[model samples]
Target: MNDQRPIVIIVFVFIISAVLLTKLFMIQVLDDSFLKRAERNAIQRVVDHPYRGLVYDRNGKLLVYNNPIFDLMIVPKEFQVKDTTRFLEIFGITKEHLIETYQAARKYSYVKPSTFIKQISTNEFARIQDFLIDYPGLFIMTRSVRSYPEPVAAHALGYIGEISGRQLERDSSGYYVQGDYVGLSGMERYYEDQMRGKKGVKYKMVNVRGVDKGPFKDGEYDTASVAGKNINSSIDMELQKYGEMLMKGKTGSVVAIEPKTGEILSMISAPFYDPNSLTGSDFGKSYTALNRLETKPLFNRPIMATYPPGSIFKIVQSLIGLQEGVLTPETTFACNRSLVACHNHPSPVNLFGAIRNSCNPYYHQAFRQIINQEVSSNTYKDTEIGLDIWREHVMKFGLGGTLGIDMPNEKGGDVPSSKYYDRFYGNGRWKYSTIYSLSIGQGELLVTPVQMANLAAIFANKGYYYTPHLIRAIDGDQSKIPQEYLTKHDVGVDAHHFDMVQDAMVQALFGTAQRALMKDIQIAGKTGTAQNPHGEDHSVFIAFAPKDNPKIAIAVYVENAGWGGRAAASMASLMIEKYLKDSVSRSDLEKYVIEGKFMN
Candidate 1:
């Protein structure tokens, strides 16, 4: 028994020695994870943020650029301050704030760095840079903030903000970290991949106090950051500024496009804050205040807001009526008030006269013909089939759907299908009479201002349009424009049908939209008064100038402005003249719209 026990002890000793030898082998050569972790403790890893791309207008005028800023970073494990009061005074922060920030950094990591104070201006950083060396754990990390040369096109340019937790979780590329900034909206959000650039990594030797000693291995392990590609937008800056100036003190939107290329010239939503207000250290406060306002200055109305097409839709109706063979140029209808409420106009008018006078009864009767084409024996079934067909035609005109602009969160205005109506009023339960409001573009039919502008472009081109876009080139390469933007979308209407519609639209300017007339440019336009249950009617207008070879096609809407010709027509006229002539001749009309006197 004594001999067996000695043998067992020998075996046990041998087993222990084998385990120790294996562990030493792993520590010495087999595994390097532990060694890498130890290196992290001795060296500091810094992220090299690339410069964001610059934004320029079509004519090579700079619109958006980056301004140098700094973030004060800290490592909680190495942080020490002898004079706490002096430190707070130097950074212009309260003692409580400093403690809170330190606690957050500690919670994030004991050795890794985190942002303590963000978006420090160049002047501020210059004043306190020398004092930063006194604090052992603190260092300056350079960053850039977006700057606008002028306060125009706030919604189009957008702003950047700290990455949210949800965005970080969704980030599949793993490029962004805790303190990274991301584009939140507008073009910034739409073109983030092109505008954010690529981030680089750098290694530096540091002491126990987390101070940057020097570049580790003389930058042998460092990667260079590539700056973002610059963008050349299609917007005409002068026209955009002029449009915004004319839209001040109003509550609505304006959208203008070049008819030949479908490039957006101007997109203005009134009651906008300066883009700078959303930049720098005061972003949170400014955004909060703007968000709480009743007017909703942050709302991108041109692409987001939806309204009934009103009488401007009559032009579309005329084109559809012509294409469907339901009505002809010589078709006449009585100015019958009993059919639908309409303003006083000539009775027994032809198609051209109906458009010129915006005759409600003419469209009401015309819509009935369109929706009761005897496709089914049952009256209800026939109306349903006809409405579905009508919807298909309307959608081709870029109505009731998103136009796919180079912007985010664009709301596709409702072009209610038969299915939509079936859900609302039940299948086979409703007929044309039940949804007659759509006859004059006032029912469930809705459209965004940008879509309205596109419709005008469609008219200017006679039958087709390109998808509207804000970006024309990237890094001076026009070939980089998306294929979809260059692709033409035909409305499927015959070219001859548009000639009659165009003539009617030109006649309309001589009638209801007399204020939109130009002396030498020869304008064609239509005005609308959309019914508003909340307040007064919304004034709306759609127009294109130089009726022969139109340059700019525009749409304007003025909320609670009552008459379309009073405000909307005048604004559209001014925008057209400003784009073609580079100046406006009608000072009285510009003052009338800008001063908010049109409502009175």
Candidate 2:
């Protein structure tokens, strides 16, 4: 009976143990929500930023590079500050700043990391590293700040900044996270992907004391960051520097393009700011200062500003007239001095002489002939048809619209159409006489310095031009032009018309703009004193030299500089000589351009 009782008790105990084992299996294997949360609490995923690409000039000179900067980051969930005062002193931040930063970090998320201090110098970073033992979960992250080697071309190279919220929404490849830098303007903005390299990831293991133990899993899951591809720009650094020097204390733009390749050699927008001003710890303040400057140095005048082409428009008008067979190169017109009457000149001037003298009446006569020509024999007999044809010829030279240059935010200067004339003058009611001022490049005909430079390039190329571009290549590979940009449209003028125009332009240098000629160099240029409705005339000069096998074509506009033969012309000549021959032929001419003073 005693043995039977012992067996019963043992069976009862076994039954109870089985029930507890089943319950443990249900909690451990069937339900895993709590265990997954525990695993997330312990595992930390950190992003490793890739190094940004470097920018080089056409000569492979470094333009933009990166300087290592340290950011003080805090993981609030793991943060344990033993001595707050010591931490603040090491980081060179105030106690109030630390408190505010801590509060902000907490608000972001306890598990998430946030940067409390930014752009601490290398020396400060060393100090922080030595005292890191006093602060747990506070770490130093190495980041890069843009550094400019030459400190010029602020508008061309542009600057990088933190990605905005709007940008994140637009691109969700996780390519950019918080605190990522992005190109904001110029070529930088235009080629963001090529410039911003792929980011890599690395898993790191840390000890309880917040010290990095080593790579997790022997670096098997780690990725090496791919540095951004190197960029080769088309800018001639020396020419760009010289142009900026010529434009010192002036308010205007100068754009020089290689006539053969449509490469922008030098583009200077005056009142320039140092690109170094927009980097490091003082970036925000310096940006604000530049934004508030009176002259608006940040504005890229070459493409952003539009002015009347003035006498430059006469060149296009003459070409259109010749192409339409309305006028020949030997066709003569008499200039009448009387403003109100058409019968003023009996002294007949040929096309060459008329262009050299910048005869307004001759172009007036040519413009009238163009407006009278019909698009087709059976087409509508509207005067706007001829004007439209004239506009088409002008546009073929890359006017009246965006030139599709590689730079960001280029303005397409106004090219009024027949429809626009219809709106202003009523349908078929206006005559070419009503818009005679168009012959002289006035009355709503606007062009930018970039467009002006392109016009000179077209003439230099004798027919066609590559789309003006700033970036020459990325990582040693030449940039491919888009198909739309490769098509060439003619200006409707034959080869003979350009030759005559070139000859006249050369004569203008020797005749009207004689003062602009440099010794031993034959410069073909035209001067323009464009009337400014707001202030004094804007002096402008467009030129290319040594006339045969031209190397550089340029346009310079000096606001309120009076005549184009004065500051604008001299500047153009000096720049041409400096670029083509590597030295100005006349130091006296260089001195004149350097020291020339403008009245209003």
Candidate 3:
């Protein structure tokens, strides 16, 4: 029994020694976590941020570029300020702010680095860089902020900001860190992946004073950052400047598009702030102030604000009426005020004259014929079926749905369908008489300014359009623009029908829209006065030039600006003349629009 016990003890000791030896081998050879931790004590990882992409206009004029800035980073465990008051004064930060920032960094990570002070300008960095070495654990990391040379196109260009928690969670690639800058809106947000480029890193050696001591291990672990690809936009900067000038002191938007390419020439939303105001260290304060304003300067009205089409919708009704065989160009309707309210015009006007005169009763009579096609014995059933078909045709014009423009937060204006009405008034409960308000572009029909511009393009192109887009090329490659923008979308109407409608739109300038006419150039246009329950009627206009081969199509809207012929048409005319002739001959019209006197 004593011999067996000695053998058992020896075996137990052998097993314990083997386990210790294996663990020691693993810690020394296979595992590098402990080694990395020790290395981190002397070597700091510095992020090399890439420069954001540059933006240029169609004319090759520089629009957006980057300016170098510095971020003061902090590693909490290594951070120490011997003179707290001096540190606070040097940074221009309150003591409370310093403590709060440090506490937040510690909560994030004790050993890892975080931004202590963000977006110090080059001049500011030069003034404060000498003092940074006085405090341990603080280092300067160079970064960039966007700079706009011109203050135009703020909404179209957008802005960049620090990565939000929500954005970080949604990032599947895991490319972004907490302090990383990301595109927040507009083109900046839409093309973020292409414009962000790749970030690189370097293992930088530093002493206890937090001063950089050259590359660690001769930069064996360093990577080179690739600069972001540049973007060439389709905007005509001169025209954009002109449109913004015309829209100044007004509460509206203007969107101009080239008819052949669907490239956006200019997009202007009034009451916009300078793009420079939203850059650099003051972005937070500037944004807060802008967001608090009642005018909402940040709102991208061209694609976001929705309005009724008013009389300009009569042109669509005329084309649809011709396609459905419900009315001919020669068909006449009496100027009856009993059907719906309309301004004084010729009685018993034909389709051409109805469009020229914007006769509301003509559309009211035509809408009834289109909706009551005798498809069903029951009048209500016939109306329901007819409305569904009519909606299908209207959607082809890019109404009641998003045009899929390369912008974020675009609102697809409402085009209430049979189901939309059924939810309110039950199925088969509403008839042609109940929904007659839609005949004149009122009721539930709504459209964005960009959509209205596209409608003008459709008329100019004689039945089809391309999706509107702001980007023309990426990094000098034109093919990089989305395929959808290059494709044609036909609106189902025959080309001949558009010709007749085009003639009537030309005549409209001599009829109700005389204010939009130019002496030297032949212009085709339609005016609208949308009913606004909150205020006066909203003035609206859509137009294209040269009568035969159109170059540009534009839509303008001015809130509470009385008649469309007075305010909206004038602005659109000036824009057209400026684009086509490269100069405007109508300074009188320009002065009238710029003075903001049309609201009276």
Candidate 4:
């Protein structure tokens, strides 16, 4: 036992010694990784951030471009700070700033390069470049910042900023690192990979003083960065600017679409800030200020703001009725103002006249007939099946959900179903009268401005619509856009059923929206005044031009605006005129819209 114990002790000592010796050899001799790591003390990794993609309007007009900016980078070990006074004067920073900033740089890294002062102007860089060589540890890193020339479509183009720690972790692509800028919203965020391009690495040898010694190994290990692909958007910059002009001083949204292609022509969220304000050195300050405002200038209203679709939704009801065989163009309903009081127009209105006059009682009975049709012996079961069928057909119109537009934070508008009612009112407890408000496009029928424009496109195409999209082409190739955008989505109603609705909508100009009539250019439009619980009623309108072979479909909403005919219908007509005629002949009407007379 004693001999075995001695042997065991010797073996344990030998094992510990062998393990230590193997690790020492691996670190000091067998493996060169440690030596390579130590060699990095003299090597500098200059990160090359690729130039982000340029943005252009459909007509090839430059919308977003890059402007050169300079960052004073430093390697804590290489930075000598020879003349702190000259450094402070050149950078225009105080002495206290230098101390704190330099300390922060060292905390970030003892050997790696870090940004000391960012977004210095070209003149500032030129003044200090000559003296920069004298201070070995300090050098200029050229970077490009986004620039917007037209300052239109601020919400659609989006902005870029430094990557957050959270973003770094979620970046499964491993394309981003600290100090990298990423798309924060809008089209920028949707096509981040294409717009960001591939980041290239260049390994340059630097001396102890942080002076860049030309390419290491004659650029054997260096690679050039590939610039991001340019994006050609569907926006007509001129029309977008005009829409913004008309919407100024108002809180609302507007979206225009090409009915056949579903390409967005203009998307305006009123009370917008200049896209340039969120770029360059002013980004942090400007973003903070805009974010704090109560009106939410940064809030994207075109795709995010949800409101009752209002009377324009009556078009859906009319279509659904015709498809279900519940009503005909000649079908008449008495508008006695008892069931749902509406503006006095005619005593009894047929479906066509009901639509033209925007009568509430017509849809009230028509909607009840839709949900209480003689489908089952049990009325409750019949109502449930009928409403479910109605909702399924409505979903085909791209309502009750997000249209899947290529933008961030697109809200899916609400359209309550049977389950929603079942949850609220319990099993078989709710009836047709309980949900009667839905008849006039009120109650739970909420929609975004983009969705409303899509509804107009559906009407223009008879019974089908293309999912609305902002990107027209990517990588200079139209094929690069998603296949879904190219596909046609049909709303199940027969095409002839749309003929009746289309005829009725055009006749509406003679009744409710007389002011929306465009000279010679035929327009089909619907006006809506949505009830608001918090403030004045919201004005809304949806329209398309040229009647047949329509070029553009549009939706406009004006918050706190009294009636649809006054503000919304007028805006839609002016936009249609500008698109079709290439110039607005109605100078007086254009003046009224641009001056915001209707809003008053």
Q: Model 2, 66-116: lDDT tens per residue?
A: 999988788888888777777666677898998898899999889877988
lDDT over C-alpha atoms for residue 3 of model 1: 72
Candidate 1: residue 375 lDDT (0-100): 90
lDDT of 1 by residue, 1-600 (tens): 887998999999999999999999999799999988877877888899999999999999999999999999998887899998888889999999998999999999998899999999999999998887678788888999999998899998888998999999999999898989999998999989999999888999877766678998899999989999999998889998998898887899999999999999888998788999998889999999999999999999999999998999998888899999999999998989997999887798989999889999999999999899999999989999999899999999987778899999999998888888799889899998998899898989899999999999999999999998999999999999989899999998998888878888898988888888888888888999999999999999998878889888999999999888889999999888888888898998888877877767
Which runs in model 4 stand beyond 4 Å of their true positions? 1-41, 82-86
Candidate 3 residue-wise lDDT, 1-600, digit = tens: 987998999999999999999998999899989888777888999899999999999999988999999999999999998888888888999998899999999999998999999999888889998998888899888999999888899999999999999999999999998999999999999999999999999898888888888999999999999999999999998998898888877888899999999999999998778999999999999999999999999999999999988888888888888998898988998989998888888799999998888899889999999888989999889999999999998999999999999999999998888898899999889999899999999999999999999999999999999999999999999989889999999999999998888998999988877878888889999999999999889999999988898999999999999888899999999899999999998878788888988866
Error of 1 at 37 (Å): 6.8
lDDT by residue (1-600, candidate 4, tens digit) is 877998999999999999999999999998999889876876777777789899999999999999999888877777777677877787689999888878998999887788888888898788777777677678777788999999899999999988899999888988876778899999988988899987777887777666678888788888888999999999999999888888888889999999999999999998898999999888999999999999999999999999999999999999989998999988999996888879869779999999999999889999998899878888767778888888998888898888989999999888888888899989788878778898888999888999999999999999888889889898789989998898899899899988878888899988878889976988999999999989889989999987977999999999988799988999899888877777778788778777776646
Ranking by lDDT: 3, 1, 4, 2
Clashing pairs in model 2, backbone N/Cα/C closer than 3 A: none
At residue 538, what lDDT does model 4 achieve?
Answer: 91
Which model scores highest in TM-score?
A: 3
lDDT, candidates in the order shown:
0.90, 0.80, 0.91, 0.88
Task: Give the clash count for each candidate.
Answer: 0, 0, 0, 1
What TM value does model 3 have?
A: 0.94
Give the distance in Å from residue 10's predicted Cα in candidate 2 to where it truly belongs: 6.1
- State the local distance difference test value for candidate 1: 0.90
Worst 10-residue lDDT window for candidate 4 reads 591-600
